[model samples]
Target: MSELFPVQASEASRPLASRLAPKALTDFSGQEQLLGPGKLLRRLVEADRVASAVFFGPPGTGKTALARFIAAKSGAEIVELNAVTAGVADLKKALEAARYRLGQSGTKTLLLVDEIHHFNRTQQDVLLPAVERGDVILIGMTTENPSFYVNAALLSRSTAFEFLPLPEAALERILDRALGDAGAGLGGAQAALDPEARAHLVRMSGGDARRLLNALELAVLTTPVEMDGRRHITLAVAEESIQKRSLRYDKSSDDHYDHISAFIKSMRGSDPDAALYWMAKMLAAGEDPRFVARRVLICAAEDVGNADFRALLIANAAFQAVESLGMPEARIPLAQAVTYVAAAPKSNAAYLAVDAALREAEQGPPREVPLHLRDANLDAKSRGHGQGYKYAHDFPGHFVFQEYMPQPVRFYLPDGQGDEARIAKRLAVLEALKSEPKAGRKGEP
Candidate 1:
């Protein structure tokens, strides 16, 4: 029930990211849209008027830091709970303590819930009354889309702010600050970062300030001081410190949908390079090869359509290859399918045609099949089902004019691209033949 704060570690022992966390808004590196001068969020925090709100975004974007800063500025008792670790009982205790403090000492508690999206509907619902009645100012932080994961009632009562990845310039500024700040930063280390090393850290951080600082700290702390009395962090040292760039991707979150959407759109837009890049990023981030293959297959059918009939074949082959041979080797077939689909002539005509026909079938009045086109074997002689049927194979060019449907409807207009161009020409000739009068009908007119 006691007010919870981030575990207090000694300054010397705490991680650089924790030690160098911004103590003031001025020290915060990024999120200009939210923390910039005269912004609504900044004004709210400055005025100590921040109530129930949700901060959602990728990590190292200053959500938690801002929450702590808000609590400090408003002089409110801050209670921190990680949804990953906290249960219903823990939540109840925090809320009860907040209510008691508010009533007894005229104090307000700022409840910071990290990864709030991990909480189920029941857990989220528990915070609604406290939030609605203003018993505690709830600050829910999540990386997932709040609208999807957070309860509707809880979300509606909260102001949601999306934090973006820190820009390169902001990240650079943070690196500079961390290096120069004598009190909380590594100014005492007297470490001189090589130009290439500095750029490598910034570029590989992927707009994450904490990642940049952590890598910088590791490079400096582990390297031996040179004769010049400075620990020199070269490009090699920086690479060793942050070996692999952690791509921002979660299989069940925004990154998964966004990356796939980008990949599909790139292929549809005929940008093979962009399509390949997104595909690689998804795969590198542990996306299933089969999932990527499935998307490629859909794109071929829906976007490539009949323009390049071969595209669908290639996509299907790629899907089969992915299933047979997984990972590293599967990437080749995926690349082949992605590039082929992206470069192929695109036409959604076939896709559109089926959808338009579906709407008519589902919504329009019912109509029976034309008598001539009905099953002839059942009642060819008695019912006159096939009496007037004109067999196209019996005529020249395998062509004949006949009513195939009770009510004719136009669908499947082919866009002139790839093989569809030849199909369009063939259809045009058929239309011309249909316009001409039959051999014996000219005298009657």
Candidate 2:
């Protein structure tokens, strides 16, 4: 097999991302933590020691770029294969060439595999021998978690490094470089980005360097040059080019937790409009529907609590509906749940009570159950478990008071809000009946 596929495009005709790809490590825009001084990958790259490894991360986080940089730095005979298209036959051919090159001229061959996760177990196992014996340096790139997708044997033989999404500041620097590089960038076109346009592009890119460049390329190439002989990208042009508003909610970033926080707070504050808006944003941004459903369930229990016990039922039904129906359709049920939780009477009494009870339990030794409340089975009675037990049903109003715990622990303090006020009224009447003089001691010890 040929060592490399024929190059398809001329340099001038290449895409912006390909044209501006860093030729050296120093020119790389992001991944400072990995390529910084004393980092493992950097040390390995700098020493020309190419290890069989997997670069795993989200899309557009420099996995393929890093592999290219490694191959360049190693000064080895390199062959790139995409796992999506290449197979075991291609692997064998590559290895055959690698072995011949090493034996003939002592040249190391680096096999850079993109989308390594696409290969199944059987296909992945084919490379173990060469990788284990150090005959070929393997660089596999993937966007999925390697632990779940890659085979154990193959994964064990390779080191895996996680690449994080590029930060906004790093992306800004990349944009600046792309605009100023005369040969490979938009410098020749005298293109300029308006302040708001630049901000929108950065936000919409979601920390992906390739995405930012693509959007910028689209905006500049399509916009007409003004009389000033300069192509200016205004916010309106940027919006039209991108074709979607930026929500800035990344599932792996802090924005995910922050948005959830806002959604729950809005529901708790009884602002249906805000709650629905946040829910819409989350759903539109491709957030997991189950995740949103789970949060809504929690809000129903903690915020709506006993004041509107039905809120829990409604929220749970909505969750079931969401699971049954996936995206686009799931949004309807999710919105329904959000609006219901927000409109329902709000109370956190149950939430506070459970937390208070847990704290008291943790502070002291376990308390014994009072004898009257203990199990009254055949064997339990032998230990005087039900000695003073009086059936509440045998008394007036079916409400005789009796001790339940050996130690007094007052944990539940209802706030007398909504339906909780009714419970408070009933408990007050029961207390009066239990404390009234000798007449109230009919069933007491």
Candidate 3:
């Protein structure tokens, strides 16, 4: 049979790509964190506690496969639905049947809905009661942010399982498996991928495993076998494929997050070369220069901090210039802003401060506003309005050290950022003046 088939299963396996489809959970590649021993999903399946979940991720990241595994393990019958084509009535019938089987045959119903985000609130609302009652195990798959797209009540009933894109190592393993799978034994065909082609395929696929397989299949299927090594895909052939690919940088999909992550990390690593590379990537992919500008401004404040106050000003200027000048010409100011912020001093102090303050806000008491600082605008404020307010500015440098914060709260703990050092020094001097009783200004604690 092996000799006759040259591939196993169906003729689909004869293609280098199709041969590697994992039929079972154990055979699946990538997502070791979910499958590894002591993993949550693995434990849930074994314990029969596989809760209804949302498998969120990029394209071809194995959401369907994982859903199948869950249904298989839970002694359930899985009914698949693509929210795009499936209507509310179909959903109602599907759930009803699943519930019937669950009650009669001890077979729990797992409704695996793909692109759950595409379903309108009406459709999602239909599923809410059943899910809340555990009538059916609702497994939703989406490439979008569930928080934004999913119905709140339904979301509350199910857990969310995030699946990131396959890493390089995992993608490489997928490639190797495709080569070895007898079912997909197109390996027997007369074509071998060169080093450059392999690298190009991986890079172009952008961590999407399905894309890698499909591209590999297309590349081989399209090329006419030449005498010189079965029309091996040269870098040139691979380049053509990549060139033809559409650009979608600001797509707010997985690509947006992935690209931004790479850009920021590259900058943080002090690699201008990589920063520029990602910059070009963002530009090529049509990322909003305004969005990029905003990010730079935030990065300047959060990362660069006081190290280079100029970076902050430049980022803000870039944002303004982008709005005023528009594209083509705006790209210049945007580029300059990105390079400057990336090259500036990196500090996480400001970032950490807000985080710390929020943490404290969560834990500490909400202290009442100081009596003197309370709003006196309304007529209800006639009671001792601005009564204790001392005109300290009349006495000194229009500055008075006062305990304005209720509960002794301190939010702005400035660090030794770019120009922040000068500001910090000024604060210290003012603080010292308040402590001096001779200055007739008692330091307010």
Candidate 4:
């Protein structure tokens, strides 16, 4: 079985992240919400009352390190199994050993399963009995959301703690500590990092301590030794160490939904800049341009409505452009449509009117079309289908007061935004005409 905490190895051979793993709670950085004073997890670890729990979060967030720390503090023997490589047989073997240790010597085992979500449901079930009987304290770590990937029964039996990315301050403290520590860090190298270079590493690491340490190690080791026997890490060297900013986005997981939701909401909230930024991020991350175009199309019709009917036209054009052009070129039209919809005078009156009408049509009693408004071309005079229907074109304004529905219902209430203001005014005038006496009515025979 793998050691919970690997023995201190040659600093030259081991990676900086592995060598500098937190040995105690005080040495751990970030996750104050979970590891803060009086916190439940902290209390459990301090009292050796740790139970079956799932540690879930993005990569390089210290899930595995924290589990090792728990084992060290509680004096529990930890057996590590990676769900990616270890199968059902391996899991069963670990459980069997845990049971043997527990029964024979009263020594508790802490089973640390990394990427536990990769284990299939049947494989997960094998560990359930062991966890229930208190044979082993299961620390299942995953990057995926437990509620989505883990079995409901298994999830219910475990307490889930989410680890967030280390903030800038926490990462800075860790960097400073690592640079100054002579035992396991780069202190022996005597590297001096410029402030701008330090900021670049921290920002580019995307709040991942492991990533930060890796970059710092690369910069320090790569730089030539100066006359003063110190290696200076400039911003240019830092840039080369960690070239690209790490973006926490998975096309198939929570990041996908969260990003698109933000994109749509930004447009709805009338923040054109935010909408553009999200769109750029999605496209850069290889999101389908067509999908984004479709969302822009929806936003235009639903949010812009009659306030700016041209927004829908532009969005539709953008969708067509995406279909025809595809990628690189498609982003231009998509951005145009997104920004137009975001900046347009907003109104959801048409969207609300249709939904409200649909609800009444679905839940309320259905009403027949008024006889006057019925088809005149089919047996007109025979059934009075078109009788008493005022010919509005023969009168003033090309409109007349006439019953259109057997049971009248008012659904559309314009918010008087942009073009809808004219619509509201026209409707008000028509309403006044409806109240006029029949004697004073024009073109009435």
Candidate 5:
């Protein structure tokens, strides 16, 4: 792959990232876990025994770089394809070319698919047969989680290596290399960046080396030459060049779902601080505030329940407020609801009770309505719709014991918390009255 590109004498003609990319494992920085002494990947590449594998990680984590390094050392003809633009036809052509090359002179081909997660299931399946047959050694590079995006069968057949984001110290080392190398860096141009500017660049890059280098190049190329005939990158220049860092968030990706799950669990776990932190992250990433509000409402019912009835009201109010007022402002009510729900006494008794009843109903046919409990207004006298119904208002304490169901049934078991405690006591008294042995009365206790 290195020979595929013409060697350019002038470093300024090429992108800083391309010029400074590590050509070997020794040159590559970060990922000590994978590339350290005696690591599996390093041993495989060094021994020229590279197999079909997937390198998955965030951007600027060296997925493609590592793949190229392995191919260079493997002594195999590497064929690169961008999954974003390439279709099944392109994959078929590449596979056939690999087979032809292999048959002609016993040469091997390593297929490097960049952004392999972008390929649909069918496109990924096309590589499965060839990869299994060893027709082409497949190396897939993906920023997304391979488990969700790649075919299960394909994933099972290949080894998956995780490339983590470069740490700050590693990024700093890369910056120094790019600045000091004469042939492939800004050394010949005598470009210097201020300490403050360098710090800003490193921090804003969010552990992405490519982003840091691109911003540095833009700052150097655009800044006017100083009196000493050297380009100086200032803090202001760095800020202007990289106005905003690319957030590590994809709305339709795994991170988005994971964040939301964390937020909901935080609230349910009664951790207000954790809940607020996740909410802030989502809001900063431009998530829908209404979605947060809805989750709060659910948490109130499912977690707080009768233990703090006020929680549900507050959550509902917050939901309405969020609907009326869009974000920035809506974050207030959402935060308020989250805190209230977190502080409220927690109980899942009601949630559990409803689910239990629902399961019973689903397991069998619907229960029939008792004749005494049917609508009395609809021909009550002729059909005896309200037969055997006892009027509770006429009795002492405005309560009467009567069978309301054809068969006995009990679903709700209230937890003794807040107002539910009093309800539980009252239910005990009523149950006692209903169970007291009758003296002489018929159909009465």
Candidate 6:
């Protein structure tokens, strides 16, 4: 057999990442920003260039794959080592081999080390000469912060590319691909995914493609199949496959969107119990705390508003707490925050105000600020800039007569809802004071 004609390896021997490993950048699902045209890695490969590089990200984010991919393309010799397995002596051995091979063959060297964060400072310093002299391109991968874990001497030489966890949509696509993949586990199983189960697989996997596929592989295998025309996997089967009993859960897939919808609607409907229930469901489902906090913050400002001003504060504080503490302990603060927001007085008055303002602003030239409100500090500024702008503090009760809104611009008509009803009354008195300033004894200078 000619050395030029390569044989594709059998399916079972391949790790899912290998079997599913995208042959080209085109086959790769995630890292669109990195793989899209004019991207960093793509540019280096296209130029037949070797840059000392480090890929920093969470596990299974294609870091090692990227290292190997670059190595294969560059016609370089790869020296592999896991930090856990390789000591200073083993590292020196690999360095010797890579350097010797490079010198003999006129080849560039790629040292693909996984969890390079595990390398001690002294161990890492050994490779500095090779990296600096361009004898080897050190392609290091780490799940931890490189700035903290890596030797500053070595860090200075490499370009660090931070990889991100795939989004839910990309994860969804990955799940489908894994199940639909013939060479992988799901092919002969007659598996038809339940909407909820599919979502569960994605949500539980938590944006790790390897995790996602492994769980989906496990889930489908656990499923009991039935023959309708062919063996079709069912919701019950998926439930059994996932958690053994089944959940009406899955964030991006089924229960994720559903619970969020339920939570929002529960708040809008002023059903605290339902809202809290949905909130708990989201947390238990491993929904990101920041995501949950973001929604509550929106609900506080948009759905509760002045009806319960403290809701926004609570929601914001909860977000901060979650960020500081992360999981487990953070859940308590999040739960307290959600309960507070849900129990608060309901009012869409603020959301309505913005919605109305945007609608009117988009409608016509009236969107422009009144001349009185325009910037007046610069050259050739008009006289009307602060002319009728009454000094409210100069009068009693810090109130004064003024037409701040020029004409009849009513962005927030108050809606006469909840506390807004009282706010509307106060606004009426202000308008009246402007109309008949003399009668407003409270506004007299």
Candidate 5 residue runs with Cα over 4 Å from true position: 1-11, 189-195, 224-232, 364-371, 377-385, 391-445
Put down candidate 4 lDDT per residue, 220-294, tens digits, no spaces: 999999999999999999999999876777788778988999999999999999999999999998899998999
Whole-model Cα lDDT of every candidate shown, in order? 0.89, 0.84, 0.74, 0.89, 0.86, 0.73
What global local distance difference test value does model 2 have?
Answer: 0.84
Q: Kindly list the per-residue Cα lDDT of model 1 for residues 265-384, writing each as its tens digit.
A: 999999999999999999999999999999999999999998999999999999999999998999999999999999999899999999999998999779987778878998988888
RMSD of 4: 3.0
Q: Which candidate number maximizes TM-score? A: 1
| Model 5 lDDT tens row, 301-371 | 99889888999999999999999999889999998999999888888889998998788779855678777
Model 6 per-residue lDDT at 259: 77
Count of clashes in candidate 1: 0
Cα displacement (Å) at residue 439, model 5: 14
- TM-score, ranked from best to worst: 1, 4, 5, 2, 3, 6
The TM-score of candidate 4 is 0.91
**On TM-score, who's better, 1 or 5?**
1
Q: How many backbone clashes does candidate 3 have?
A: 8
Q: In model 2, which runs have C-alpha deviations exceeding 4 angstroms?
A: 1-7, 245-282, 285-308, 317-333, 339-392, 397-445
- The true-structure Cα RMSD of candidate 6 reads 12.7
* Residue-wise C-alpha lDDT for candidate 2, range 318-425, written one tens digit per residue: 999988999889888888888989998888988998998899889877887777777778646578877788786776666666776667777777778778888778
Error of 4 at 7 (Å): 13
TM-score of each: 0.96, 0.70, 0.69, 0.91, 0.85, 0.54
Candidate 6 C-alpha lDDT tens digits along 218-323: 6665555655633455556555544532234655443466679888888777787898888777777678878888898998999888777788999999999999
Off by over 4 Å in 1: 1-6, 439-445
Candidate 4 accuracy as lDDT: 0.89
